[model samples]
Target: MTVKNATAVRLAEILQTKRLENPIGNALLESAARGDLRMDALQRLVGTEAQAHRAELAAYGTMLARYPEHPAADLFIQLAQLVYAAQPKLRECAKALGMSDAHSSRWPAERATYSFNGTLSWLAVQGSQAACALASYTDMKVYFSGCTQFAQRVRTDGIDVPPEFLAYYDDEGSEELRQLALDVVQNGLDRGDDEADAVFCARLLEESIGEFWQSAAGTI
Candidate 1:
C-alpha cells in the first residue's frame, strides 16, 4: 500500500492542523540555506547533530531489545546501522566546519538540544511500536530535509566539505526506509496498536525536534 494510506499519515495530517512550524526553526534553515549562518553556530549545529546520531543508535538498540520479535525490531536494527554508518560522514561535516577534535571536545552538549533523543528513548521503553515508528518517521523527515538543504546550499556556495559527505544526504535510499516505517505503522494497526497513541507520540517528538532547531537558531 502507498504510504499516503498509512494511518500515521492521516493522523499526522490532523496533528499538523493543531500546530504550526516553529518560526525560529524555520529561520535557522533559512540562514543555512542562504549561506549566512555564523561559523560558531554552524559548528554547534554539526556538533549537536553528531550527538543526536549517537543517541539515536542507543534508542534504536533499546527498541530492538524491547520488541525483539516484532517487525519494528528490524526497523530499529536498520536505523541503528544507518546512524552508525553516518557518523564518519558527520565527522567530516564537523571537520569542514573547522570543528577539530579539541574544538568539539570542549563543546558541551546541551540537555535542551537532546529533547528529541530523550523522547525517543522514552517511547522505546514506554510507548507502543506504532508510536515509536510514527514519531521517528516524522522526525526523520524533518531532520533529513534540513541536512539536504544544508548540504545543497553549502555546496552551492563552494564550501570545502567533501562531496561524499554532501552526497550522503541525497534522495537515493530514504524512500525505502520511509516505506519500512509506513509498513510498521500498518502492521501496528493490524495488531491493535492505538492510533491516537501514535499521533500523540508524533506530536511530542515533533515539538522536541522544533525545540532543538529553535535552540540552534538562538546560537546564531
Candidate 2:
C-alpha cells in the first residue's frame, strides 16, 4: 500500500535481523547497530518528540512499569494514549465488566444494538486488557482514517457489498452490522481484541448504526 523510503526500507531490514524479544523497543539500538536511522530522525526518535516512535513508547512503558511515580508517567499515558496498561480507572472498569457474565447470556445478532455507554465501557475493557494491541501512538488516527474513507464511499457513491457487505454503509441496518455489534457484546471483556475491532467496523460502517440499532433494540 505505502512505499517506504530508502532509509525506511533499510530500517525495516535492520529491525527484522535483530530478532529481538521486544522488536519495536529495540529499533533504535538495532538501527544504530546497522547505522541506518541517523541525524534528525534519530535525534527526534531517541531523544523526545511529540509523536513517540514505537521503540520509544515501548521503552517508556517499560520505565513506567518499573517506576510509575516517575513524575511525567501520567503525562506520557495521557499524551501518548499508551493506556494499553494504565491502571486505576481502566483497572476498576475492567474488573466490574469482568464480574458480569460477558457473552454468556448474549450472542451477536444479525444487526447492531447501539449502547453508547456500553460501547465506551467495552472500548476501555478491550483496550486496557489487550496490551500492545494498538502498537503505535498514531494507531487511533489510522483506524479513524480507514473508517472515514469507507464512510465517504457510502456517503458519496452509496457502495454496498452483498453477502459479507463490509462496505454496506448505506445498509448498516443490515444483519452484518448487527452481527458485528453482537460479536462485541458476546465477546465482552475477553482477552483478545478482534471482537472489539468488530464493534468499530460496525460503528464506522454507518455512523448512525448505533442509533439505528438502539432504536430497534428488543424488537428483533
Candidate 3:
C-alpha cells in the first residue's frame, strides 16, 4: 500500500480495536436493543449530545480558521454544517424523552462527559489537521453505530418519537464524510505530519469518548 493508504488502514485497525473494547458503548447499545434503557437515562443521553454538538460546531470553526487553505478545511466546514442541521432533530428527540426546553437547558454538565469536547477543542486549536480528522473519525465510528442501532430499535419497539430524530446520524453522506477525513489525513501525511502524533491524538480522543460513555452509562 502507499504510505497514505497504509497510515489510514493502521489508524482504522487501532481504532476498531479500541471501539470494540469500549464496554460502555456495548452496554448502552445492548440495553437500548433490549428496550431496557430507562427513559431518564435516554433523556440524559440526548441532552448531553446536544451540548456536545454545540461544542463540536465551534471546534470545527476553529479548525477551519487554523487550516483555511487546506483540504481539511472542507471537512471542518461540512462537519459544522451537519451539526447545525441536526440540532432541531436532536431537540425533538429530547422532547420525546420528556425533556422540556427548560429541562434540557438546566441539565447539569458532567465533567467526564465534557472531557471529549475539551480534548476536541484543544486539538482544533493546537493539533495538526490530520490529528483532528483522525480523532473525529475514531469518535464518530462508535457514535454512528450506536445511533443507527438506537434508531432501528426505537422503530421496532414503536417508540413515541419519530426515528427521523436520528436520521442525521446515519446520513447517506456519512460515508462521504469518512472519505473526506481520510483524504485530509492523506494530504497531511504528504505534507509531513507525524504519523505517531496523529495516532496518539486519535487514541486520546477515543479515550475521552469512552469516558463520556462511562459517565452517560452511570446516569442510567
Q: List the residue pairs that clash in candidate 2.
A: 108-182, 110-175, 111-178, 112-178
- Relative to the true structure, candidate 1 has a C-alpha RMSD (angstroms) of 3.4
Query: For candidate 1, which ten residues in a row score worst on lDDT?
Result: 101-110
Question: What is candidate 3's local distance difference test score?
Answer: 0.72
TM-score each candidate. 0.81, 0.21, 0.83
For candidate 2, which ten residues in a row score worst on lDDT? 42-51
- CA shift at 187, candidate 2, in angstroms? 34
Output the number of the lDDT-best candidate: 3
Can you rank all candidates by lDDT, best first?
A: 3, 1, 2
Global Cα lDDT for candidate 2: 0.30
Local lDDT at 77 for model 3? 92
Kindly list the per-residue Cα lDDT of model 2 for residues 1-220, writing each as its tens digit: 6542332233223333432442222222333335453333211211121111223345435534532432224433542343333223222322333322212222223233323223332333343312222221122322234334444543444433232223221122223322222222232224344433533433332232223222222222
Worst 10 residues of 3 by lDDT: 164-173
The numbered model that scores best in TM-score is 3
* Backbone clashes in model 2: 4
lDDT of candidate 1 over 1-220, digit per residue (tens) = 5655457667666666655543225445666766677656556666666667767888888888876765788788888998888777767766665667422462436666777668888888887888888886777766777667766777677766655456555433477787788777767777898998888887788778876664455542
